[model samples]
Target chain A: MLGLAAVPLIADVIDEPFYTVMFSRMLILSIGAISLNLILGFGGMVSFGHAVYMGIGSYVVGIGTFHAIEDGISWMGNGLIHLTIAVVFSALTALFIGSISLRTRGVYFIMITLAFAQMFYFIAVGNDNYGGDDGLSLYTRSKFYNILDLSNDNSLYYLNFTLLIVFLYFSHRLINSRFGILIRGAKSNEKRMENIGFPVYRYRLVAFVIAGVICGIAGVLSANQTDFVSPAVMHWTRSGDLIIMVVLGGMGTLFGPVIGAVAFLFLEEFLSGITEFWQIIFGPMLVLIAIFGNGGIDGILVRLDKWWQIKK
Target chain B: MNWILLLEQIMNGLQLGVLLFLLAAGLTLIFGIMDLINLAHGSLYMLGAYLAATFTNWTESFFVGLLLTLPACMVLGMLLEIIAIRNIYTRSHLDQVLATFGLILFFNEFVRLLWGPIGLDIQLPEILNGSVELIFGIRYPAFRLAIIAAGIIVAILLYLLVSHTKLGMLIRAGASNRQMISALGVNINLLYTIVFGLGAALAGLAGLMAAPIMTVEIGMGEEILILTLVVIVIGGVGSIRGAFLAALLVGFIDTVGRSFLPDILGFFVTNDVADTAAPAISSMLTYVLMALILAIRPQGLFPPKGV
Candidate 1:
């Protein structure tokens, strides 16, 4: 934590603003990945529609900014309003989707979640007022004039970093709580949990909404970071990227998603630098990873720690 | 709307339905017999279109190009199975989905590298180039009619092949009991490859047929692949009969909805908003239907008998 706190300072002395921006994006994605871990890793609910929350979050902020500028809705100018509405709207959307999708199990659940995300993607594309397929661009980032200046790169980076820690700590506390335990319990054996008289559906639904709300926050930060929001964010492929991060970092681990985001985004940066057609390489690499990459980087680190402790 | 236009739109819907059936049949068969979820089945459809375009351009004949594409696509599908898909059969569904997603990326990029990012438009044969009179002073595209005719012919042939042939019996047996068929000394692996190849060929046929009507372009397979997934899901995962019925049903609802949804919504909303929202809501109708059906019957409309 201390070392991370010095990243902006070190990058500044080195005159590398790219590190600040890149790391901030990674931190935001980590929050998204972490929330995904909440349901996907613990609840065993493989939601292929997770990105919709983020997209929703982005659109709320982006569209709010658009209205704030064009229609002179000054109240919409505040980041706090964006956060409030984004969280609420995403929670309701998650509740609605999770309710219907949770009725089906296994493959059906995956498909339905994906279906809803695609449905939303098309909806986002259809709305022309918010830039639709081309995406919305913000001339100014989220404003909190007295408390925080989002225009400052370092402050924004620190803000994202702080939120990441806050969310991480919150997730860790939640996971060890009775509620999170029940969610995990349902995942391991839904039948067993139901036999014990737990309302498994309601528990999972709550977890799904929590994950959505958190991922939506990430989207707010993401829109602020990029100053752009588009329907592409709601695409199933973005959801796939989040899934890859969760799986790569090691499912069911708090810090795993952060690491997954780092590894994934960096690898993407490196590979895309090599060729515009980096997907050709990335495509087969994912196949190989799915085939051979068993325990993710976090899992490997955990295994190594156990081995070292045994040696000691 | 004019009666002629409405009838034409209905015909268009049937054309689309049969095209969907051509793809969905193969997807369902692969799932039924192999119990494999191959996302790259759409890639086969894409390859079919590209090959059809290339071969037609080469031989100066559409039929010949399409003929050549079927075998080419079958070969590609089989090879892909042997290399990539065969490894994931015993793996988890997540792994299969991810690995095939990778395949989609690779195939899309590979096609881009080979064919370039620009879309290829296939030329129609002289016989199928112009409109044909269907009734008194009403006409429709001959090629679209051909697609419908061809789709029906393939559907009937598929029925005979599945219901009557020795291979069909084995496929059914395999779908019902993989262990029993394996114990009976059937080459299950070979069966899997053949079924996958057959599925690929069907997808290819649909793509080639569609090429003249639409641009054969990069990532085109993915757009339609989701629809095929919906068709199979609504039809029931392993039922061919279900796939055909569901494909046509989805075809009519989607095409007809897009055509008329705006007008219907225009009565309720302003013209501009209706026009803007119509495409999205129309496309969403199929998924909405899927959700409604799954809510009512989680097992799908016609789940095949057995495990």
Candidate 2:
């Protein structure tokens, strides 16, 4: 948390303005990864369609503003309204999808979630009014109630950083709470948990919705950051990317996804700068990580800590 | 409704379903026996199409190009299994998913490096170039008919091989009980290699066949891969007959739904609403079907006998 708080000053000292924007994006993605970690890492639900919430979050802002502009309506200038609608819509959608999808297990669950996400992607692409396959661009950054101007890059960066820290704290609390314990227990063994009289389905469903709503907030941050929304946001590959982030950071560990988001996005930016076919290297690297990286970056850090303690 | 148009649409659906069957067959087999979800299956499909397209350009014969491509893809599949995939069979599904997802990124970029970003258009052979009359006032492309015919023949051959042959017995045995088959002194490792190779070859064939009608491009495998997953899930994983039936069902639903949904929706809604919503609804129909099927029969329509 302190490291994130120091980023702006560190960047200022280094005289790199672009660092703020890049870190802001990374923070938004970290928020999403943290939400995914709640379900995938703790709850044992491999949702291959979690990106839909992010897409929903973005489109809520994009489409709300588009319609507001078309009708000359000023109500959408409120950031709170956008945040509320995005969260509510995403939560409701998650509830509906999770209820149906949670019935199956393993690969079936993976495919169903994936298929539903694709269905939403197609719908978004078919919406010609909302820019369809082309996506929508904002006329202006979302407005606040005379509190903070999102149009300013520094304000936007701080806003994302603050929310990320807030969510991280909330996630920390949630994962250690009694509800969090049940979710984790369910992940380890569902049948046993059920045998012990825990309503695993209800717990899992709630976790799914919570994850979706949290990621939806990240989606809101992303739309403001980019000032655009497109169907591409909900693409299956995006979902895959989120899963990669969670796994890479260290599943079931708080703050691990934050590290994952920074590492992955930085590696991507660095690699793409070097070559057009960067994924050729990135792809094999993922395979190696899965094969050899014991429990992701967090696992490595833990091991290092142990080694350091032993040496001391 | 024009009968000819309807018939043509059905044929289109069949063509799609048959192609999906080829992809799904290998997928279902691999998942059934190995319990490994290979996301890179589509990568192999992409590779086959690219190789076939290049080979056809060089050999000047589509048949020779396809013949050369299949064995090469099989070899590649076995090699991939040995080098990378062997380690993951014992790991969790998440690991399998992530690793294969990586392979997808690699293969997609690799293809782009070789073929450039633009898509390739495979030329149809002279023999199957034109349309043929199928029914009253209905003409379909000869190549499409050939695809359907080939798919059916392959399905039959696959059925016969799995049911009546020594290798098929081992595969079936492996699907149900891998340990017992291995304990009996059969080479499980060699069997796995052969199975993986066969699955890869089937996916490759689907790719090559699909290339002429569709643009052969990077990431093309992924486009159809999700649909194939739906097929195997609805059909019941590990059962070829289930995959075949489900593939055709899904194919017809999707193709027919996309073609005719607007007209059907027009009966209840305004023209503009129908026009806008039809494609979305049609695209969603297969998923809706899968959800409904799964709701009633969580194991799918035709789950393997023992499983």
Candidate 3:
């Protein structure tokens, strides 16, 4: 809450493109993290392959815009058509993968998802038409029917911010709904849910699809923000990064991933600026967090809230 | 296809399988005995390659380097188990995954910093450098044959140790039930550390053996690590026998697919398209095998009873 309230104030004081760009990037990444938390945190699906959704999303925008600029094929206004296609494609892919993967449990599921993602990563690297390992560039942002100019820094920032708000709202509502209760219950105890007459697999699969769709949206924004899409986006290591964000923020909390994404990126930017051996420091820090900080940043906030309520 | 080439590819597949078994043996043992998923197992392999390359450079003798580095890696393995891994036995898998994943990042970067990003060649000793003539005018690298010999020897030793000795019984017992082992007054912590150290040493040995044939470099562990995971998944989580068999199956399928899939596809599709699509399709072979295996038997081919 404090971070969201302070965003405009921070924007006002910074008044620079570089800071704005950084903030926008943080928003997009946070969206990705939050999307992952839906499945991993709430639905109890530890998919080590979530970054594929982002890759699919980014590639959709990249390919769509590339064709628009190169071949002059604008099927619809701006790039909304492409964004929708990306979301649907990502969701369908998730459906296929989840059906097979959800059949296994524990470490097997994790490894299978990881292997499938690596397959996708390699395919992206091998596709010569899509620039192969070099990646594709979007010379122009999505047209969006000229309702908004994505090239403008402020316009893009607001666009990302608005999407972030919408996503958070949807996530909030979904988690509070009856469907959310079933999913969370399944996460806590799948057998118990099954005993209670809920088809646990169906609920988890739905959650997985929802998470993939949300991630797809983030992917489109990411491509537009960076003006590039590459195989790197889908790398398993990137998926690991999203997992770190969710865990660091306090898994199962609505805003925990958001806080985690902010802190993680800021720490990366800050530490890398300080030294080339930033990962050495960051890596151990994450280990220490996993070992000691089980509750994450949000856990600390919850404690503070309790203390404040007592004081009042 | 010519029979000789086909036979050669089969041999190559077996050789690859033997190499994978060397890596998977330790990995599955660690997973089975300790209930720990050590992603950093790959880092140990990477370290072994690095250490072997560096030591060989220093000693100017591959034999001497291998002799010296074996104990050095074993000691490093024990040290790592004591310092970092011992504390995580009771933690959740999520925590284990994150912490180990962090270790991977740290180790990869540390290796790059220490050895530079470029790959190093670990030259084979002259004694094992040449190819040996086989029947039908076939020839195979002597070092790879040595690797196969070493893998079989280790597998036999592992089998004898696990099935025929006191330590092996304890390991089997531990895998079956950690709490029961503890109840029986076994020093479970020490046992876990030993198992982990052994696993690490095995991984290091595989790395050292692979170094001369493949370029020793950072992140080499990641690809092999995934293959090892597949082996464990197909073989069964806690069964060494499963790992050995699965490793061979996976290795043969992968090798044969990559080698023969193109020519086979050429008979159906145009040569140009077949050449391009074959490699991609071939790469999916292990994953397809894994999916099929899961579909048939979710617990894997040889999951330890009750696991």
Per TM-score, the best of the predicted structures is 2
Quality of model 1 by C-alpha lDDT: 0.90
Whole-model alpha-carbon lDDT for candidate 3: 0.87
The positional error of residue A258 in candidate 2, measured at the CA in angstroms, is: 0.6
Model 3 / residue A208 / CA error / Å: 0.8
Per-residue lDDT of candidate 2, residues B148-230 (tens digit): 99999999999999999999999999999999999999999999999999999999999999999898998899989999999
> What TM-score would each prediction reach against the true structure?
0.97, 0.98, 0.96
lDDT tens per residue, model 2, A44-101: 8999999999999999889777767778777875688999999999999999889989
Q: For every candidate, what is the interface RMSD in angstroms?
A: 1.3, 0.9, 1.2
The model with the greater TM-score, 1 or 2, is: 2
Using lDDT, give the best candidate's number. 2
In the range A57-176, model 3's lDDT, one tens digit per residue, is 998888888887788888732677877898899899899888888888988888888878877887787777788889998898877766889887668878888888888999999999
**Sort by TM-score, best first: what order?**
2, 1, 3
Candidate 1 vs candidate 3: the TM-score winner is 1
